[model samples]
Target: MTIRFDGQVALVTGAGAGLGRAYALDLAARGAKVVVNDLGGDPHGQGENRAAAQKVVDEIKAAGGEGVPNFDSVSSYDGGFNMVKTAIDTYGRLDVVICNAGILRDVAFHNMSEEDWDKVFAVHLKGSFTVLRAAWPVFRQQSYGRVMLTTSSSGIWGQFGQANYGAAKTGMLGLMNVLKQEGVKYNTMVNTVAPVAGTRLTASVMPQEMVDKLKPEFVSPAVVYMVSNECSTSGYVIEAGAGNFSRASMVKGPGAQPGMAANLDAEWVQANWDRICSLEGAVPMWRAGQTLAAFQAANAKQA
Candidate 1:
């Protein structure tokens, strides 16, 4: 295959099943040594099973692919470090990491408890972060690495009974954003995907017909490409599922900005509310300095 991994090693979190399993198999089939990590937890982030990870590893080996099983949780720093350590100890180095481990605790904001909130955040947001922290050093030393964070439409848009889930999932985007920024210099790139499929997590909400249409393999392309050498994108949130792929972006529109000497009061905000939310022209992705420059340009003539 032209898209061969050759001698590379890929670490896939939650690889016991679902999209992570798909990714692990695909990479291994393409010649990568895979590290399959799974805490073997329930959809609510409870329980464990060494067999979940072991089974996937066995399958990879049976298919002529090299892989190791890891049962460490990603929510804690030590666990994340141990997972990475396993890859390094077994294969010498890592070329990719798909932080796809997650749990769902669906509840309205009013009814969501602190435990639910913390658990979701622990597995999806901080979990991804902890893994990256472990992998960053190895990536920098090698000067190459691919990272993909799993997000969701519920997190991207909105959904009832997903206050905890949405908050945690969306935070992955923020983590990817900063990782993208920091990784630019070190060549350790990071990106995100909001996937839809018939995983154990989504089997209840998504209809079976739709699930059949949106196979986990269809979502694998986005992950494979993003975590491959060919993909140069970072700080991006792409959506893929059911054989359709699209991108998500943060956009900024030119808004009504009063000059330096102009009043900065509720009246000003009230009057310019329309301008504030307008989207007539295409919006641009503005960086921190760019926003400052826009501010200066807007008030330049006034000064």
Candidate 2:
């Protein structure tokens, strides 16, 4: 079946360019009224240009879709509130939120300043919180909502010289885990996207030829579907780009328990270190309690 948004409204942060622009355009094309929000900052989160946002809104309108421009920084609580307010005021209600705004401060951990860390977190981690927190009430009130948060490979796995960015990106997973549970009863779904796309954020690090191959548009399909009513799964992490899509998840190994002895020591752990770190019998954990449950089950078996 073809997925569409019809009467739904969506708010896309950082809609001025790149992946955010691609997502906003696609969502609008699919019949959703979109709020194209962009602080219009440079790739490093500096400066502003109101036209950056208006241009996308214009594109949406030119395509015969409904949209409005919002020049608000997602890092600010008030900015996030106003972004949601613009959607509600213009389209009446919001059904989707795509937290795609971000800035880069790539530096080695030793060289990374507190300012760099704070700024990155403010835009990525705190920015996500600000917007989602504002939209949370509406989702609960309406009993239906869809959310897509942007994560990165740097955060999901690891990359040298990106401690701040990685930390902030990984934080999205934690947020998704809790929000998924809270929104389940309300019919709200929250999922994350770790997009491997060639955008402004990666232009400096990636080769020009590779950038041309990994278009931002290639990642939008998965993101759009994740935020559509047709998608019921929540708390999922999808990696998409260059027409490739895959699911990433947190898994736990069948850990060595070292018996029920109260005085389990470093020696016991050392003896079973390989077993403790082995992934031979690892299982994907869907919830936090599952890890503990697995441990209890293993203890019972030992008894």
lDDT of each: 0.88, 0.93
Worst 10 residues of 1 by lDDT: 280-289
Segments in model 1 whose C-alpha atoms lie over 4 Å from true places: 284-286
lDDT of 1: 0.88
Which candidate's TM-score is highest? 2
Candidate 2 Cα misplacement greater than 4 A, ranges: none
lDDT of 2: 0.93
lDDT of 1 by residue, 65-172 (tens): 999999999998999999899999999999899999988888778998999989998998888988889999999999898999999998889799998888788888
Candidate 2 per-residue lDDT over residues 1-303, each given as its tens digit: 389999999999999998999999999999999999999989988998999899999999999999999999998999999999999999999999999999999999889999999999999999999999999999999999999999999889989999999999999999999999999988999999999888888899999888888998999999999999999999999999998999998888777775685568888788889999998878777788887787788788788
In angstroms, the error of model 1 at 133 is 0.4
TM-score versus the correct structure, for each prediction: 0.96, 0.96
lDDT for position 60 in model 2: 96
